[model samples]
Target: MSDAAAPGQPVLADLTTIGVGGPAVRLVEPTTGDELLAAARDAFTSDEPWFVLGGGSNLVVADDGFDGTVIRVATRGIEVLSETDDGVRIRVAAGHPWDDLVAETVARGWSGIEALSGIPGSVGASPVQNIGAYGQEVSATVVSADFLDADTLEFVRVPRANMGLAYRTSVFKAGQSHPARPGVITAVEFELHNGGGVSEPVAYAQLASALGVALGDRVPVADVRDRVLALRASKGMVLDPADADTRSCGSFFTNPIVSPEALEGVPADAPRWESSPEAQDVAVPLGELPAPPPPPAPAAVKLSAAWLIEHSGIPRGFSLPGSRAAISSKHTLAITNRGGATAAEVTELARFVQSRVASEFGVLLHPEPILLGAFL
Candidate 1:
């Protein structure tokens, strides 16, 4: 194990983005996969609680802190494994900053992940959440991941198909019920097209509007990155130390998906989108003849959590009495720490938001971040 894993470790407040967690009993920074495996073994065999930390961008730890080992994956490397006619295949270590890799791929004119620019956290955490934005999810391009299976205590390579990747979760994120199946992602491989200078077709409407192009039009990859960065900064999604609004977990809640029956009491004007049965009741393009309808199918609808919060009388920047945490002034979806907020304060604000939305709309907003010794 690395020397940092010794006693008298730094507080988790210095490790996470929101800056609110308490001290860890022991902190280990593993610079190699073997070192990481050894550290995990030592902690597990000793019957001590342990947690793996990545960029710490998407976690909220309790103020009382954890009384166990904290392994910080600090291994670093990026290797080009192959360049086929279809695309380039590369493996990135878990410690590599996610946005830096996106920038590198864009600079090299790779097409698949150009739209994922400016997201925080590490590559290993991406598959855990199946991270996505502006219509592109990391699951789309992942070839496989190398992980240490806690069950066997051995290294294994799992293909993307077996990862159980869904909207914002995977099998790696199993809860307490799967105690014997804990796994730590070591690295991820991706397949990206050599698009020369172009990017994948613009798939999100807001992004297309920002670039002054129609949906599905491919623009320069560099331009896509710049536009995405500008858009994220506008909403305080980009990380900036001087910006208080950026001191958040990006979007605090995932867009809630509901069945059609659940929408009966919802307002007609509420912002929603079709999540399943893609062509269900959708209008055809002008001047195009409508094709024969397929058999009726069930549809899943996605509702905007921000809209629910705002309509439930919780505006942007809303905070409870004397709480140091407040919703982001730029976006209702984010809860930010004004300064010196505690984990309890953040949890209180989140619970308040969830209660208000649920009471008003019968929809409970679930937190997107992985809560550590904290809940909403």
Candidate 2:
């Protein structure tokens, strides 16, 4: 582990997708699990604050930068611990690129994650964020995650049930507010199906339409992966150095799960979805669409944040006059860095968007990225 800063050392901006943050006071990149644990232990033991950076896809750091140690999880490996007729259980190192695992799984006929293609980040960030897209979430297949508990400085394995998996969050991401042990994840295990190379049934409507199939249809895993990648790329969700729209956190805000009463003023045409995992997984009847449900008291409904933002008069690509930060041109959910934008500019734009949505819809949107030394 090296903590010395050099004249041309990389800054947090250079490491992050949005390219906005300042430099790390001390940077630690561990390429092995043992090194990662040691580095984490040292950081935790130190008086200085610290953060574990993954693939850097879902972070927004302040322009002033992190004042303490920043440990980058860079370990890599994929190990199959067991296999059966039904499925295969594999353990992945925390630093492994997330999409690389998805691609590998699809190529090997492992069907669980085919629908989650094109998401950027490290495998370790999966359970932490409970990352989901196109109707697939890591919680559905994750068996366990190994961690080096900071409080005790002992390594432990946490089962899926103990992770507190929820929409876009888990115990790992909850920080001090949660009762669960806090630590840095070292690896994750997942059980993926071997369904004769076929993917799980398509549960999301858009994905089904893209594949020219009805909901509940099963297609080749490779095909599912290909289409998902294409869809994400078109929306600027995929990482591309040439695409300025991709220079931001994948999504700036989480889809708010709110009381039905919060939707009182939202337009009847606004999109809504059931917030429960089971409900979200069920496919709608082919060729039939249900009318929007009226706001029902006590039932949680997930609203489309994009719809709210757009309806609030914030169009895609909207930017404050002369500001370097702007909404993504391809998708309204992201706030992009036009060029050399600072974290302050990004947060300013974010606050503007939040105010508009809250004023127009009476519902507040929460940021999806892990902000370091940054506030909304």
Candidate 3:
């Protein structure tokens, strides 16, 4: 329940993990339910361009700074509503860090979101983008996400089915943020597995193979989390400020799921699966060729966006002359800040990659993070 910045107080850069962006116009941290609700409704009534800023991880703010009020959802809580052999019902505050909730659930031997172990950002934002990692997305287990219906100015806890969780997007993430159209997510509720200590059947082939086990194997929940974290750490997906690769917002683009026709357009050796050059080639060749002479890339395949970027001739760390920002040297999907780069500069580099990928692969790559002030 703190007041907005008084005067000299600096903005998000001091607190955000990204280490960039200009000062926020106004930053409000609402610790109580009434405060959060009042601030949201007030901004709505006044026609203020308000955004519910959370974890600040999966966001890229512009250089000019947000020119409107920013409601920082600092409201926090995590409670076990029920426990049983079938499932566990629990509710989490929107402001809670996503990984913290995952860890807590895993620690208590819960088996729903363990595979989303290393993802960054807030619980509220999870439903917004359907935060995903390894083989698990928050959408798979979310029973409901509670939000203040900005339109009606009332509490509405929409069911998971109504949230519209796609590969890595949702209604909240897909809509515009104007007075006429804004989705202010407040909290989320999940129903996790309490069926003994067994995990959900492993879905990702890479994950199953890494555990030296076959697909559909149900290993210990803890082991799955441990293995997933190790893999993400290697790719700098898990946060590490010292390493520039980690200085990125995880994977920049989602793995493209192309139509059957789109699949046929792609070549046989095209880096198809995510995670590697050879692995993609291997995944396709392992099974019998799909019918229809192999359309673009089937909805059957998850094309590696990083491979597309590299093959597009924009190698990691490749930047135009005299630019501080560039692609990450460790991975191509991540566009990095090589120190002293402004938000606009980052935006420019991002556009360049998208343009190049379009020209090269004929696939338009979309940004995965929340971009403010300008489109990514």
Maximum-lDDT candidate: 2
Clashes of each: 1, 0, 11
The order by descending TM-score is: 2, 1, 3
Question: Residue 124 of candidate 3: its Cα lDDT?
Answer: 87
Using all chains and alpha carbons, the TM-scores for the candidates as numbered come to 0.90, 0.91, 0.86
> Worst ten-residue run, lDDT, model 3?
278-287
lDDT of each: 0.82, 0.85, 0.73
Question: Residues 1-376, candidate 1, lDDT per residue (tens digit)?
Answer: 2212235666887888888887778899999878977887787666777888999888887887777788888888889999866689999998788998999989888889988999899998899888999879999999999988766777889999988776676777744112224768889999999878699999999999999999999999999999999999999999999999989888888787676766766799999998854222222221123355454457778888899999999998889999999999999999998999988898889888887877788776667777775331
Clashing pairs in 2: none
Give RMSD to native, each candidate. 8.2, 7.1, 7.5
Residue-by-residue lDDT tens digits, candidate 2, 256-285: 776665668778889997665211211112
**Residue runs of model 3 more than 4 Å from their true location after superposition:** 1-9, 175-181, 271-301, 374-376
Best by TM-score: 2
